[model samples]
Target: MTGEDIYFAGVGDVHGEMYEMLGLLKKWESRLSFVLQVGDFEPHRHEADLQTMDAPGKYRKLGSFAHFYNGSAVFPYPVWFIGGNHEPYGFLDRIANNTEIATNCYYLGRVGTVELAGLKIVGLSGIYKEHLFEKRPPIEEIDRHSNADYIGFTENEVLQGLEFQRADILLLHEWPRGLMTPDNRLDVIDPEMVGNEYARMLVDSLKPRLVLCGHMHRYFCHQIVWPDDTITRVCCLAHTRSGSNAVEIFRLSGNRSIESLRSLDER
Candidate 1:
């Protein structure tokens, strides 16, 4: 879309809180160009689909996704999301990557890219698992393995992500390694286990202007300044259950530079 400025929203893990998530964005719906969600969306169509997810039973209840999928409820704006550790593989695997699963809700797939509002948005779905790093079975064969098999991004996906020379925004489900330092370490998590190296590699390679991630269910912001003095801002969002800190708003100028960035949770 051509415009002097484009406004949009970025959200962290929904974890099946679809109605609540949508409610929070309602105030900005008319002004937003679109919405980006950083995985763990859990768009289960029904109880059967919810059963196929890899999350613990306690966290496995089907949320409001079916309402949107069935057209009983409509999304206020276009929504794009990736796959996280807790997702309905049974339903999502049936659909091709980068395809719209619902009216205005899209699945960004394991590795996918799209241009929206004069911005190139690239996404990598799923978390990093050492054993699953080297292999990515075809979607058709996904049913042959456990849900865990499709929960980690593979090397092939990373290679696909590298194909993009640059991106305006990079969407990931997990944080990139090296974000945690003495200045930003959280008391609850071990510094060494904060993020994954593969994600860090993508950030280093692609050098997107903005990197968005969620999975740790915490709010964090960091800037990685390249040798050339280019800065890549990384924002990790908390779960939607946590309220305002889970969402942020951004406005990009016509020249494709970020004009403003703010958290919806900000007072």
Candidate 2:
């Protein structure tokens, strides 16, 4: 069976840019079924700032977004958001949405699964801060450390708490470069071994068919070979520096591709 065509207007780290993006999305609702974003809604909260602050109430704009996002006053599609390290809460898995936007925004926190048109979608969000960056020093020092603990904690939460041991579609925020990819090659990486270790564990253990992530936003969309001849399509979308992006689309008729899908983004 051919894969269905599902439109996903996904973007992240827009922070103050949500209003502009939201307007554009309204015009393109006819062609999309859902949307996805990887985190960093607050452009101000860099990795260094997250560890130092105890209560990031300053970034309450997200709460406002949640209020509107969960409401039907304005929106045309469902939004699937994974917690970025910038997300100030713990286990962001709760989801509330309205039908006017046809939007069902769900944040899986660490790990989750979604079924659309007979396809399975799984995800894990938020940073593994407890293990990676519990203590905050200076801004300079925070950068020196790695977000592996944060990544690992998220993974642990998904695997241990959610019971998503075997996912057909896995979503993670980090990419580990040290483990053997689904293609059986050593996935070379930099920074903390734990970050690589954590992601690699999913790649090695879960062996999903597709994995979408958005942490090292350098524009990544490729395939990895895992054990048992399984291939994992890992995608890292580049957030719009100006506007929104056409990141997701679904067609039950199997007419899915970046080329044929409608584009309403005005970025």
Clashing residue pairs, backbone N/CA/C < 3 A, model 1: none
TM-score for candidate 2, please give it.
0.61
Query: With candidate 1 superimposed using the best TM-score fit, by how many Å does residue 182's alpha carbon deviate from the native?
Result: 1.7
For model 2, residues 1-267, the per-residue Cα lDDT tens digits are 344555455554444355554665666677766666666543222343344222345744432354454453344566665556655332221222211221354555445566654545565555555444343232244345443323334434545524556665566665545433346443435333424455556666677665556665445456666556656666555554533332433233454223213222322
Highest lDDT against the true fold, candidate: 1
lDDT of 2 at 176: 48
TM-score of each: 0.93, 0.61
- The residue-by-residue lDDT of candidate 1 on 184-237, one tens digit each, is 788755787788999999999999999999999999998899999999999899
For residue 236, what is the lDDT in candidate 1?
Answer: 93
